[model samples]
Target: NALTPPNFIKSIIEEDLRSGKVKEVVTRFPPEPNGYMHIGHVRAIFIDFALADEFGGRTNLRFDDTNPAKEDVEYVNSIKEDIKWLGFQWDNQYYASDYFDEMYNRAVLLINKGLAYVDDQSADEIRENRGTLTEPGKNSPYRDRSVEENLDLFTRMKNGEFKNGERVLRAKIDMASPNINLRDPVIYRISHTTHHNTGDKWCIYPMYTFAHPLEDAIEGVTHSLCSLEFEDQRPFYDWVVRECEMEAQPRQYEFGRLNVSTMVTSKRKLRKLVEENLVDGWDDPRMPTVSGMRRRGYTPEAIKSFIYETGISRSQGLIDIQTLEHFVREDLKLKAPRTMAVLRPLKVVITNYPEGESELLPAENNTENEEMGIRQIPFSREIYIEQDDFMEEPPSKYFRLFPGNEVRLKHAYFIKCHDFIKDENGEVVEIHCTYDPATKSGSDFNARKVKGTIHWVDASSAVPAEFRLYEPLLGEDEESEELAADETNDVSADEVDDFLKKVNKDSMEVVQGFVEPQLKDAQPQDKFQFFRHGYFNVDPKLSEPGKPVFGRIVSMKSSFKL
Candidate 1:
């Protein structure tokens, strides 16, 4: 159980302890309970939990559930489950809603201190008062209210005495600062909505920027870990904690968020895709969500490995999605059992084999884990090969089936195509091949050199299955431009809007196929390599008894034909 060494965050924590920045470190992962956790969240989770683990500190799982309008118990539970699945335990479970009463009292304290005020102006009017980056903002007309009047108004605002968004409690910070967040940010606003946790206890709620630092200070968190988007808001975060007069003000650190190419991680956009039926659900195997990756058969070890290999860098960059797929492929290659499945089946008749006779062929279950043992597959006269396995007219480099070409039926015997039959459509209906009786696979077949080996399943022994092939969910050009925008270098607003319009339309394709008999009883999440086919995982949500649904994980090679 050797632990790996320091990323920038861990390095900082180590140095902090050496300098006695407080005896031990404490970190917190505060995710808003609005949507499922995605890979981007995993990066923060790993850094938060892993850094704590390295320094023998503690990590808290806290839900920044201030936005009750979108937050739900469903999302909260999903976040907890995903973190546990990633193999991290929370030192304590807390919610921003848990401190609603305390946060309200703090707001009252700010009003009594004349450091905050109740503004009756509309949200738009407030925006107008807050001038451009190059100009100073004018103060609110009510900015000079007596402390007693402000406290009374704020108390009424909390008591459900005002319409939603009619009034907001604003921090009385400088309006002329270059940082917009510091221009008297909204600490709390009126919202007549029921909270998932508190349930109709209050009508007003605290905004994220105000609640987050208060949460860190209350929990005694030593390190407030967040993404780079929060970099500009760092000063406001520090101000809130300081204004609260906390003894130990938690330090905030920012790092670039994780981005994967060809994948959209925005919750709003992902929700749009789900609501528009662009995908089956939030857990669609092609989605970048943790649940989606789990359904797609990606192992926890593979995800952890990808996180480690990507490393923690302050410079933001878009990671090639293929890199993540490659780790999954490499990890599964040494673990998953091998089987045979024929998609787009083509009939092949072993003309020389006795009619009504079948043979048991030995096949390796897993090449990397021999102790997994081998399984026996039924081989018969009539078999099904991939439709693409044969070409009626052969190319010079083609090593597979043609009228006179010889190839090995994997794990069985070498067969030479002698003839074929065609239907009225001129499509090859069946291929006739003669087996080399002396070259049966278990005997001298291993020594007989062949240009190609193709996978086949016994026609009568094959089990019906559904194969799901996934492609990129965004158009090539659009995805590239979107990636550029996310890097925050530069892009026109028109380009941004048009790129979002090209969201993936044909992201999923389902087809009927046949799998080996061993797969008839396969359970959910069972992973396997379909011999010459790609790696697949049994989809738990769509799979049924005797009717397995498999999602293609990744191909054996980039040049894979089927």
Candidate 2:
């Protein structure tokens, strides 16, 4: 458990502790709880909880459930489960809706101080008037409304008098602030939708930026940690806390967000994949979601190690997906037991061996760890090897099961291909070979060696299982193409429809396979290293009591050095 040393956040905490500027470091992970958590969220969770742990402080898990229109209990529960599975716990759990009463009264206080006004513009109108980076926003005609009228309108809006988007209360900040977020941002809006937490009791909900800082102050959170995208909103965050007269003040800090090449974590894109029947579900093995990775058999330790290596910084850089796979291989190398599986089963008949004769062979459970002990595998005359292991006419240096060639059958005996069967299509149906008993594995009579060793399973004892191979979830060219589309300022439904074409049709490849008899009772989430194939996990959704579906976690190769 070698932790990342002395990064910027760590340095800040150390200095704060030394200077006595902060007696107790308190942090919180406030997620909007609208969708499933993705890999980018890993950095925030680790930093928030890890910082508190290093400083002898506390961290709370808070759900910023301000907009109930898109939030649900399923997402809320899943978020909590993902955080727990990531090896952390919350000191206290709170929701933004839990303080609706206080938030409502605080809005009244802003109105009483003549620092706020109610605007009757529609959502589009507000956005239009909010202006752009170069232009100053125009004020609403109702901006000069008296405090008494503003308070009345806000209270009535809370009583469900206003329709969903009729009117919204705005903080009376400068309309021409250079920082656009400070220009009279919306503080409260009327939403008729029932909330997962608050139910139908309240119709007026506080905006995220407005409620976020208030929630932090109420919880006495000393540090409000979030991604760099919220940097522009920091000013408004401070304004809400200060104007509402909250006693406890928390400072907000930003960090670079993690991104992976060839994978898009955008909620819009992910939801498209789910809604259009492109992916199975949120826990689809190809997805970057925590549950998806967990279902695919990615160990928490591997994810944490990868995150540590990535480290915290102010600038975000794209991480190649291979780096993540390398960590998985690194963590599972010494843990997962080695076994043989033939994904595309090709029958191999050992003509020289006695027919119907099966015997048990000993194989190391894990070559890197002796304490894991050995597992017995059944070997017989008729066995199954990978279809790709044999070639009728292999190129030069090819030593596998071609005609008139001798090769080793991993942990078994040397087999020389003598004949083969073919179907009407002229495809190799089965391979016929003769075994050399003297060259049995672990035998001291080693006079020669073959160039290649392939894995196999006994035909009689091979358990039928499904192997799911995955490519990049995003199409090879979709990353740049989609970014280009964004730059064109196209938000039409037709533009969104083009996403289906951009999805990687080859992302998931399912094939029937045969595993060793030892894997007969392999349960869901069980992991094994298939020799020459890669590490795989028993898929929970598709796996049954006797038959299991294995999801390829990562192939057993890497270009990553560390």
Model 2 misplaced regions, further than 4 Å: 1-5, 476-496, 558-562
Per-residue lDDT over 422-534 for candidate 1, one digit per residue giving the tens place of the 0 to 100 score = 99999998999998877877685455588888989999899989999898787443342223211122345565456457876777788887999989999999999988778
Q: Please give the CA lDDT of all the candidate structures.
A: 0.84, 0.85
Pull out the clashing pairs in model 2: none
Q: Write the per-residue lDDT of candidate 2 for residues 272-363, one digit (tens) a residue.
A: 78887788988898888888889889998999888888888877877888888889999999989889889999999999889878888888
Whole-model lDDT for model 1 versus the true structure? 0.84
Q: After superposition, how far is residue 334 of candidate 2 from its true place, in Å?
A: 0.7
